[model samples]
Target: MPGLNVLAGDLLNVMRFYTRLPLPVFRFEREAHALPDFRRAAWAIPVTGAVVGACGALAGGLAYLAGLSPLIAAALALAMQVAITGAFHEDGLADSCDGLFGGASRERRLEIMKDSRIGTFGGAGLFFALLLRVLALAELFRLMGPAALVLLPGIAALSRAVALMPVLLLPPAGSQGLAASVPLPGLPAWLLATGIGAIIHAVACLWLDLPLGGLVSGGLALMLMPALAALARRKIGGHNGDILGGCQQVAEIALLLALSSAANWRGPL
Candidate 1:
């Protein structure tokens, strides 16, 4: 087995690719390893999400410029994320919604979440989620122009960063949910790093002249997880991997909607 230092280094190497940081790696080994911990990959989830979100925004913006319907572009961009991540969180979100609403017992809910097959509730939940995202992106693209294209990935990263709050504050409820499998991050370390990330995101927004869009709107978007975490803890007993992913999806959607609205009402800063 690789030493702890080597393992940590390897993990960081894999993670660097997901974040905005620039790091180089050897060519031969780049594609050799399968992502070992999909649960641990939560840290990287937002980074990958940001990439896909940016692509979607770009597709939307370009299509709008080319006279295509804004909705198509937004939908395609959303499709891109679904394609890239295989709708990983969306699946989690759907399963979670189904489990939350349809399952009668804790065990039954977990079982329903574990089933790979999509249920009626899950399907409907997914449709609404995607529809909301598509419509939201279309409106933003139509109104915000190129800035909308550039900010999607950043917004995604920020929202995922927000999802970190639960991992920092709450314990996993399930014995086998993905969050339970992921080693709990040291609260101080993760929160400190997250704070820095949040500051940087805010600074970027301000530097980009997003005005009230950054502080007020951005802050509101980021607030979803803590609120949801409080609700989940009260209702479900604790956080789980599905809950974490669900947090990410919800945060992203909320941030996008809030920012888009802010950008519309408040003129360029």
Candidate 2:
């Protein structure tokens, strides 16, 4: 019972660290302001992420069912998700793009990534990423109806865990932010996170009678993302919060597109 209680606290800690959601804390505490112990919270990443994703799914599904255009519903869903997370991952993608493309040297790249202002590459990246997500989701909802929205929680959860796995191998880019400060999880923790993500996605797919597009997307991300890791290593020496965020964003987009394509192949979603 004590172990379960501790686990629950750890999960809450992860949620507090990763999101901007308003959650209850112990009465005596001002708030959960301390950084989470990622080492212990690693397994809960997918669980916390899925909760956020489900909020978006519920919002979009309700809007579509309420007779709004699927595109508008999709946009609303995306907006809700952005609001919930405060666009945490999207900001990372922008920084990554700006740093990787706009800078001529490793130092310059890191500097660009650390800057608060978005550059031309960053702006372009943000536009395309958001556009692609909205369009893919709209098409998905059109084809699959509400079932499409149901897949989001699983995708959201899986993307987060899978995208950060590379960090287990790579070192930090600098000695400053989350990438540098958080304790590394062991192989067991990563495996636990991955296994839980897969199970969550599998249950959702089975419930919807949909193909295992989550696995396919996850596999593809694992295959393709070594390049990103290598690029980061060569460009800025190691991993950072922004780079990890970029990974999560890319993985999430790919999962959405893969599921959409798969549903289309299934005929009438």
Candidate 3:
């Protein structure tokens, strides 16, 4: 049962860190020293993401059942996700955009990212990101109807899994932030996390009988991870919490867009 306890603790830790849910309180003294163990529990990240996505899917499905338009249902679903995650990834995307575009140098970029205030670039990034997600989800709903329920959760899991790439590949940019403070997961942990994510997607595909369009969309999103990590490396020196967030946002949007276009090309899967 000790192994089960550890697994349970790790899953709770991921949920506590990533979401706004009111989970059961953990033992403070034990958990404070267990940071390294929790970090190594990167494999549970996709599980947390699945929970978040499920919440969004539930919200969207309910809205659709209540006679809301696809657009409105999609917006509510995205809003539900933002609420559940506390907009953590969205904040990261905004900060990364501000730093990457507004700052003149790498150091300056990092500085801009550190600032609590959002700037023009950050505002624009958030706007477009939210817009794209809403539109894409609406399109998916219009085309696939209820099938989006399963596909969205899988996409969410996959996006979070991809964010681990930056953490695995790049060193922390500084000594003070989240990336530095948290222990980086090694190859085994990464493999476990990604493996879980892939399994989730594969199962969903088979269960839903997803078409080529759905498969292609997921493939494209997966491919974006390494490229985004490479760009983050060149732009701001290395991966930080913000960079991870940015990766999640980009992956989510890319997946959604691909899904949207696929919906147009192929009839419901």
Q: Number of the top candidate by lDDT?
A: 2
Per-candidate total of colliding backbone pairs: 1, 0, 0
TM for every model, in the order presented, reads 0.79, 0.94, 0.93
Q: How accurate is candidate 1 locally (lDDT)?
A: 0.65
Candidate 3 lDDT trough over 10 residues, lowest sum: 29-38
- Give candidate 3's TM-score: 0.93
Off by over 4 Å in 2: 27-31
- Provide the lDDT at 70 for model 3: 92
Which clashing pairs does model 3 show?
Answer: none
Return the candidate ranking by lDDT, descending: 2, 3, 1
Ranking by TM-score: 2, 3, 1
Against the reference, the lDDT scores of all candidates come to: 0.65, 0.83, 0.82
Q: Which residue pairs clash in candidate 1?
A: 56-77
- Best candidate (score: TM-score): 2
**Candidate 1 lDDT by residue in tens digits, 1-269:** 44555545445443543333344554544443433343343344444545656666676667767877777877777776666556767877887787777777776777777788888998998888888888877777677655566667766667666766777667777787556754555655455435544554565466556767767656786677788788667656678877777877787777667777776786543
